[model samples]
Target: MIEYRIDRRSGVATYVQIVQQTKQALRMGLLEPGDKLPAAREVVEATAVNPNTVLKAYRELEREGLVEARRGLGTFVRRSLGAAPADSPLRGELAEWAARARAAGLERDDVAALFAAVLDEHFDSTAKEQENR
Candidate 1:
């Protein structure tokens, strides 16, 4: 079961957090197709969020073709997203790299900026290559 966590201080809307976490779980293979998402009531109980908030998140996911809500049963995952699984070697290597960065005194935001820069550089270059081809 997926547990929703609401960080009130994170500046992100509660519904968005739920949507993003659900997508993350899908990408990580933690939630596979046919998996039942937690009932809105359960998420509300766990996170102290409004039932409507949970519903809104599920609705957003459904809109994205990632999940569907049944009449009585909970929402079911429609498909998985992304190629990277939670246990992938690439994830392990990234974790080790993050640990090394932490040990070298990089703060969370600093590491995030560096990661974003690298992603932009690589993905932008990849896009250019595809355009050339």
Candidate 2:
């Protein structure tokens, strides 16, 4: 069973909320490859959300190659893309600061500020190093 939640209060669309939560669950190994997802109707019933919303989420997941929906069957998790390092482009050290800021209750604009500050610091340090050389 997939364990996830939809934040109705968030500005994000319902489908996007579901897609992100499902992706997080997959990345965290909470929902492993080959695990079957609830049927669209079942999901709607369980979450008290619209069936169309659930279907849209599933379609997005399918596009991302994270899940596959079978005709007359149901959706299933796809195996992880073979052994790429977890620290891909979005997992760099600089990204850690942004993640931390988000976890600390910062909004998108706040995270942007944190990112800009880090970029400025990096550029200043590089310029100083060049001057010293």
Candidate 3:
């Protein structure tokens, strides 16, 4: 069974919560490749969320190459996401931030501030992160 939950009051959008939960499940190895996910209707019933919310989440997952949908069947987990290649821009940026944060003795709060600062300084980062596929 899928171990997922949604919080109505969370700052995150409903669809975003679903995407993150699925990603977390994949990273934790709780949901393996070829595992069939609950139907969109089932997820909506379980979470008491709108069907469109669940559909948007599933669509986002499929777009991310994390899941595949079969007509009249359902969505299933795809192969595990591969490690970032050395030349990937995101990998480089993450590595740089890790080093900077460590050097600056930053904690979670600091990282949060840094993220907010980035968003504040350049609004495009938020859209870019969202658009990243």
Candidate 4:
């Protein structure tokens, strides 16, 4: 089961936010194959979003082959994405690093930008190396 959080101030669309959060859960091992997604009505009630919005997000996930809708039941995860588990050591190290950054007075946006730069530096170089090989 997952809880939906709606950020009205965020420029991202509500449905897209749902889809992104669901995929994030799947990647983090919080949700797995056979896990039943909360009913559209449930999400609607929790987030005050339109039922169609939730359905649209679910449909997009289905289109991506990430989930399937079972009539009379609900949507269920069809497969997972990524290799990182919720309790992975890599996550622990990152959490510790984040704590240190916070203690060092880095704002959330500052940390995010720094992390994104590091990711771009490392992952982009790795991708280029693979392409060159």
Q: Estimated TM-score per prediction?
A: 0.82, 0.59, 0.62, 0.83
lDDT of each: 0.89, 0.76, 0.81, 0.91
Which residues of candidate 2, in runs, are more than 4 Å off? Answer: 81-133
Candidate 1 displacement at residue 75 in angstroms: 0.3
lDDT of 1 by residue, 1-133 (tens): 8887899999778888898899889989999999999998888888888899999989989998999999888799999999889999999999999999999999999999999899997776543453353
Residue-wise lDDT of candidate 3 within 10-57, one digit each (tens)?
A: 877888888888887776566779998899888877778899988899
* Clash tally for model 3: 0
**Superposed Cα deviation of residue 39, candidate 2 (Å):** 1.5
Q: Which ten residues in a row have the lowest lDDT in candidate 2?
A: 81-90
Q: Least accurate stretch of 10 residues (summed lDDT) in model 4?
A: 124-133
Q: List the lowest-lDDT window of 10 residues for candidate 1.
A: 124-133
- Cα miss at 20, model 1 (Å)? 0.6
Clashes of each: 0, 0, 0, 0
* Candidate with better TM-score, 3 vs 4: 4
Candidate 2 C-alpha lDDT tens digits along 1-133: 8755777787677887777677666665567789987788877877888899999889978987889998888999986543333555545765786678789999998878777787897766643453353
Candidate 3 segments exceeding 4 Å error: 82-128, 131-133
Model 3 residue 3 lDDT score = 56
Model 1 RMSD in angstroms? 5.7
